[model samples]
Target: MTQTLEQIASCISGYDPNALPVAQAQEFIARLVPKVQAVERVAIRSALGRVLARDLISGIDVPSHDNSAMDGFALRGMDLADDGPTLLAVAGTGLAGQQFTGPVPPGHCVRIMTGAVMPDGLDTVIPQEFTTLNAEGLVSVPAGIVRTGDNRRLRGEDLARGDAALHAGRLLRPADLGLLASLGQAEVAVFRRLRVAFFSTGDELRSIGEPLGEGEVYDSNRYTIWAMLTRLGVDVLDLGVVRDDPQALREAFTRAAACADAVITSGGVSVGEADHTKRIMAELGEVLFWKIAMRPGRPMAIGKICEPGNAGREAILFGLPGNPVAVMVTFYAFVRDALLAMSGATAEALPPLQAVCTTGLRKKAGRTEYQRGIVSRGPDGRWQVEITGSQGSGILRSMSQANGLVVLHHGQGHVAAGDLVEVLPFDGLT
Candidate 1:
């Protein structure tokens, strides 16, 4: 997967790596992420939530011995009556983790418990519920009720020896911990956490607790990005807000480049008459300003920056939209996966779920639209979605109020009520 930017850029059909499409941008970011090569072995108990560095191979077969899958009588299938009912004397008991080693007579059966190893020379089992006990202390086997191997658990039934138990790049979950414990793994190899830095910029933007001057709004994008990055388990550095001045921005970018792996700014990439951030960004490194065919986050700039004190090292630069909602949309749509890649994670596609639209949606065919929506089960017990009150880029509440984002593709037309559309849920869908 080692690909130069040109090699990746060539895969796009129309091939404007500049005005990159959404899917192409996704691929480019995935290919460009320098997955952490450094690996450290941590105890399995401490490995939960960390990405595995290599495939986990099972050293031994699961259920290392042949065992019973149910509480039943263990007997040889050959000893069963082919057409008529049969009866056998209960000679012994086989409890779980215990064994029955006595030599049984021809007409004797072993009472076995679930998880107990099958008695020697036995191949079939009939549950105690299926057998009738008589005055003679014999168990009745109903005609045609039991089959050979019906309650037998073969050795290696759960997992075969030398099989790959878990693939690399997986974010270890609770079940993964159990699997590691089963495999007798005391420690696991994992990738190092990524280092990410973000900042907010706008002359009209004011940090919270500042004076409420005319034409000033609080800077909340930094907080949102901080929460999002923290959830990714990356080390985040908050660079605060940089004013519109070039010198102030230059110093911030320089310091950020030297200290962080990537720098994200929530503003100064649009086609407005007052955007000086792109110029300063280009002055420091190679950048591509794009008008992606997408809604709420059409204007974006991405590239690499090298500062003087960094000794020729470079850090990724993401110049996101200033609008509150647009910043979130672009981050979820783009930055999230890129950061995951940089952190040595595999590219995981967030597939959208099909849900009936409760309200109508009008969209053009040339651009992708991520309209906030509330997804829930309707009275019909079917999942449906409705757009939030306002999808304005500046209205952050639209995202806060909604539980999912309705993904309208570039080739899709206006959607009518009751029409099925694809939705990316905010919870669990990740």
Candidate 2:
């Protein structure tokens, strides 16, 4: 017999986000599961959002050699006197990407532009604005006493040779690409996107573009889940809407297990006349656990499914609730962390934020609650959150208007208007 929602949640409460203790899950998965096997060497132009497969070390010093950091005159520091104006001849001019080959003679200076390599035997640079240039190629510096290394970029100032620029298992951002380009790296090894297969199951569900039949509604959970998966950069294989047939659900689960790293389905996991996802999951693979003491998403299920040919490999399986909001919340709370772990990301459990409640809220004490609330800046410049009109699982409009979730713990009851509560910001997720 299936356990009650409260019983099931109690059994898993002590477990970490990976559904196991932190150290245990880390050790177990590290030994059993392989690192993302597929790696692609793509050009830096196309490496965004891809995980780095190896540490990037600088092959040579950045800026390679000493150069000028500003448009100025390059001369020996001793050439500038403390009180009197020192008049020197301008031997040559150096611009960006061009160098003055000749050495600096005594009482002589070279007009150097920004990013130009400093000429040999010259260490100090005075801005052209601070000096006067005569038509006869003579330069006069007034009260110019400069340091030896002033306005000069030393070799390897930005990055030294053999220094680790970026570590492995890091997701590449736009700025990361630019850093790679600065190091003259045209190609990088990155892990391939994880392929995820997902769907929704219910006899009352109907696909879009079809006529509305009696007692049928369009499947919105499938589209919403797909959008969320896309936002995470997962390669999604949408298995479409599956009816409440045991054989059909079984076949779809088998197909998904064969092709995807993880499979997600909404509905058909709760106790009902048409619920068959839990049964099929039991027959195909081990159902680790099901249900949780949480409103809206009590019938959540987590397990693994064995593929057809690959008997050893198992794909993760998650069964969410039928309510649209329940499905969305459960995906972010449970499945997102698991997927991030599989992608070699350093997964951290999100901590709830404290916010003052602007309105009184009512709830029972035995189950945890994720009430959608609107967060606004209080007159005191602190965040104040208030629950929306309704807390029903089917209220999708409330989710849109809500900016965060006011979390009520399992043992807590009603909260007074001015009491403090932990709120998870919705902007961080969707």
Candidate 3:
């Protein structure tokens, strides 16, 4: 049975919607979403960036035999003398893909190349660079240079037969595809792509190519959100912008929930704004309006939205703030990980990089702050960060000029010059 939003929140400690901490809000969202279960079989070549639906087991041992790791002479380790070099006759050469057909006596060695199978009864290899061929057919081996099992790659050393190679919920990368191909697997099962429908709200917003009237600006949140979602490898449905009217919001919310796994919107989530969007969200499903203890983004909504008169058909809803910079900060702080979880991918924690602050920053202790900053290596060979010109939430150009966000955590006060701080980089996330 599915649990209600209130019930889930009741299980958490200090579940305050109005003054929720950043960590607690993240925990709440992590528990709210469910992983997608639909699976499809596709060729390994086409499985990059898709989540694995099941565990992959190896059917055969890698290498299939003990092979040479370098071009050397394969021989018995005991044949070398204790104090000086030992000489042995060079038998037939052992090239890769062709076995040595001739038999060898106790004082004989085989000339071997890299990747060649180790001849029977030989357990060591002396690299060709470490030895020299004498005037006769004898190959000279140095004493105490190599021991038994030197430069030999044993069978099943990489991956053994019947061992689990990849686990479920793994986001397959290029290396994973190569591993699957090495195991002779041509096809793999992966979770189907996640569908996300997103749009912008407010009467002051206009789409691109449309003439803007007085007090109106083109919507930039949708483009930023779309770019972020595209990097996560999800199927995006661009719903465009919906007005602030009740009827328009109702139609947009209904259609988004009906066709997508999650619905995302910007604007009309704050307390002072019009309540049409909030009322419609509550009417459709259980919604929670949160004033999360974070900067640039404070007023936000998180809940499940259902199609009209159909409770069984619903999608997760994330109503973000209206400001351009706030939209991006909130999405990275909350929405990015939630969508990855819902897509059946394993949760990967991105460890923030610590850098020395170049200047002092004034901050309060109650709320978390994400300041756009340019992080680079200083002349002293240390990672240093400085905030972009203005830290206002509406200044989108500062965010574009930044390479990372200087994260000032809650319970932390003002920072002085040369203080170490955490930075969430934009390399992979952007």
Off by over 4 Å in 2: 1-35, 75-90, 106-108, 124-148, 271-273, 293-296, 348-388, 403-430
Q: Sort every candidate by lDDT, greatest first.
A: 3, 1, 2
Tens-digit per-residue lDDT, 34-56, candidate 2: 34667789999888877788889
TM-score of each: 0.92, 0.79, 0.96
Worst 10 residues of 1 by lDDT: 1-10
Task: For residues 81-143, write the lDDT of model 3, one tens digit per residue.
Answer: 889998989887999998776887898999999999888888889899999888996898888
Error of 3 at 137 (Å): 3.9
Model 3, stretches more than 4 Å misplaced? none
lDDT of 1: 0.85
Which model scores highest in TM-score? 3
- Any residue pairs clashing in model 3, and if so which? none
Measured by TM-score, how close is model 2 to the native structure? 0.79
Tell me how far the alpha carbon of residue 375 in candidate 3 is from the true structure, in angstroms, after superposition.
1.8
What are the RMSDs of all candidates, in order?
2.3, 5.4, 1.5
CA displacement after TM-score superposition, residue 36 of candidate 3 (Å): 0.7
**Model 1 residue pairs with clashes:** none
CA lDDT, every prediction? 0.85, 0.79, 0.92
